[model samples]
Target: MTSPQAAPLANAGPALHAPLLASAQIVFAQVSINFGAALAKGLFVSLAPEQVAALRSGIAALLLLALVRPWRRRAAFSRRDIGWCALYGLALGGMNLMMYAAFERIAIGIACAIEICGPLAVVLLTTRRPRDFAWLALAIGGLVLLMPWPGRAHASDPVGIALALGAAACWALYIMLGRRAARVGAPNAVAIGMVAACLVTVPAGLARGLPALDAPVLALAATVAVLSSALPYVLEMRAMGQLPSRVVGLISSAGPATAALIGFVVLGEALGPWQWLAIAVLVTASAGCSLGTAPPVSKLREEPLT
Candidate 1:
């Protein structure tokens, strides 16, 4: 799930008890997201990728609004706050749109691996430590290996690859804006921001599915909304509250690999050895960055955004 307000925590201690249960919660968040991606891939056949992304964002906005009730804080938000939310929403919309476009033509694992370059760039820019350069370089090299070439001519669509990279850029901006939003607003900013996201994406035919009414597709889209957005947000917040930040980073770093595995198991998309190795390398880079000495620039206090 996307971090609603900002980045993951900067400090967390190792678990003291019930490690299995705690780890399971974070792992479930990862699996649920990837599996939801797989489901979204199937929906792309009937609905345009834009349409699917729109429905997911639109429905998620409504659900989050109902759950969060942003109006309760109506007097709390200022013009500057609304502007930040709009920017955050624009980034969110672009990220999801580009991601879905990429997902339409690429394997889930490949798309996810490419999209992760966004966060990697964010970490790199935030860090000043020279030693982490090695990890960053390894990540870049891993991405190179993942490119479609030589024996992997059919690994991914060229256009999809481009879109994934764009999604990466949007995701980097999303992180920065999210941090700003967290400062002036609470997690309810997620609800407010999603409204702007809906404003941006809905015009791209978000309601197209409404007239064509099919039980299965409607059900599937709803399920995607809950699994990809609602459920993971809840699970991640809980895990973040209980577990150490380092542990969360390490476990969440498995995201790319988990996506690949889920793609293979659910969609029958298998990659070559180099592709898997690429996934491994990128994942390692992410884990290393999470443990980097670049102190978190985010000044937001670690408190529930309720």
Candidate 2:
């Protein structure tokens, strides 16, 4: 004998949990990605950044294609949808390539802080609420703090900063285009997108003359493919389908802090006090943005991979 009041509350249960679940998924994806990036940096010792990017994209594309077999659902996508996926993949390829190149010159954490500017730009352009602006300001302040001053000791390389900014632009495109592609379906969009990414990345890597196909390098590259691309991209696609672009961008503000921590733990990289403060500020902004009531489930768009 459920009362009227109880029935409405019961109906609201799943809706209340959806955003939380999506947030968790995004956070997990970030952890997986940054950790993978740290490991991929190790490969730079043996292979060029382009080669590493190529290996990751190539392996990830094959794994995703096999798993999703997007061809089976080829009829579900239109030419426009395929175009969106290709654009998304291009952004993905560029983002990975530039970020890896940046890693060659700067610490992973610092590079991530710079690269995050891309998604932050998306948030600034898309969000209109006053409170959201506050969070954006906080995030921007953190980024400002992260910039290398002219006379600062241990200053980041100028080329690295430029490359990170390039990655940031690609990341912005990845967010917007990924959402558009996810409309058709996540798994299908991502598989086709990975193929497109390989086109952009693989040829350049192979140009380096088949980088040391030894077992250790191959195994690490495959591990990076799984952790960095295959797993995180799928999780991100599904999460993006369930959340607004602004919310997703804001949630990603946690990336620098996560990357910093993982960089410290895995690569023995260290950050100065001011740099740590910047990460803290970015994390604070992310926390503020995520603390409110979740958006209604009706606002969510769920498209099955089928």
Candidate 3:
């Protein structure tokens, strides 16, 4: 028979390891997403960016629908709940479409660096902390470093920059709307939102005309759907359920750096010293803001999908 002290220690083992496991899940999700982005960029050689976005969103929706089978809970959601999920999906669709468009004209790493400003802005706007100004300033400094000054040796296309900013705005909206939709349960909200995303992306892609669909292309597109959307979404949802939002943000702050590394390894895209510095600054700013502003774990509400 175990002593009382021994019993508590035994129970603590799983509790203590839970956060570490969740953190690993988050990191893996980030890697999967960036790697998928690099693969999608390769497809741009044969498919338009919108077409690729459509394929990613459409396939992801189907996979999620099959996995979640959200229809069992269909009667539970009110019309308002669905509206929130739809709005969230629209933002998701817009974010992907714009990011892919930007990727066409710029390096994936640089595009991600610019795109992250959206979530940073969301944090700043929602919290009234005085110290948030510092994060904002850091973000600005990073952007300034990345800007296309007349004498700069390398400059991203201005149009690409604009599209990335658009993606950032959509990301901000996604975070806000996702919170509202979360009350409906994550799996249900995500599955429905993915369907809504299909409504936005598929039509735009269809406008470009269908590409020749061979087995390899279909397989590649499915891989992108799994890595970039389906797998990452599932992993992140599970991790977020177990981990604090602050920890999630901190782990996710490495996104730009991860994208850069993947871009270099997969696409042979290289950045200059200053660009690297800019990404570092942005990462620091995002992590700091997330640490300072994320609500305490006790305050977080977890809703079951049932």
Q: Write down the lDDT of every candidate, Cα atoms only.
A: 0.75, 0.78, 0.84
Rank list by lDDT = 3, 2, 1
lDDT of 1 by residue, 57-99 (tens): 8788888888888888878878898888888888888888888
The digit string of per-residue lDDT tens for model 3 on 1-306 reads 999879999989999899889989989988999999999999998899999999989999899899988889988889999999999899888988899999999899999998889888877767677888888999999999888888777677889989999998988888778889878898888888888987878898999999777888889999999998788887888788798777887888899899999999999999888889889999888888878875742122121110
| Clashes by residue pair, model 2 | none
Write the number of the candidate with greater lDDT, choosing between 2 and 3. 3
The candidate that achieves the highest lDDT relative to the unseen native structure: 3
Candidate 3 is scored at a TM of 0.93
- Which ranges in model 3 have alpha carbons more than 4 Å from their true place? 296-306
- 1 or 2, greater by lDDT: 2
For model 2, residues 31-65, the per-residue Cα lDDT tens digits are 88888899999998899999999998889989999
Best by TM-score: 3
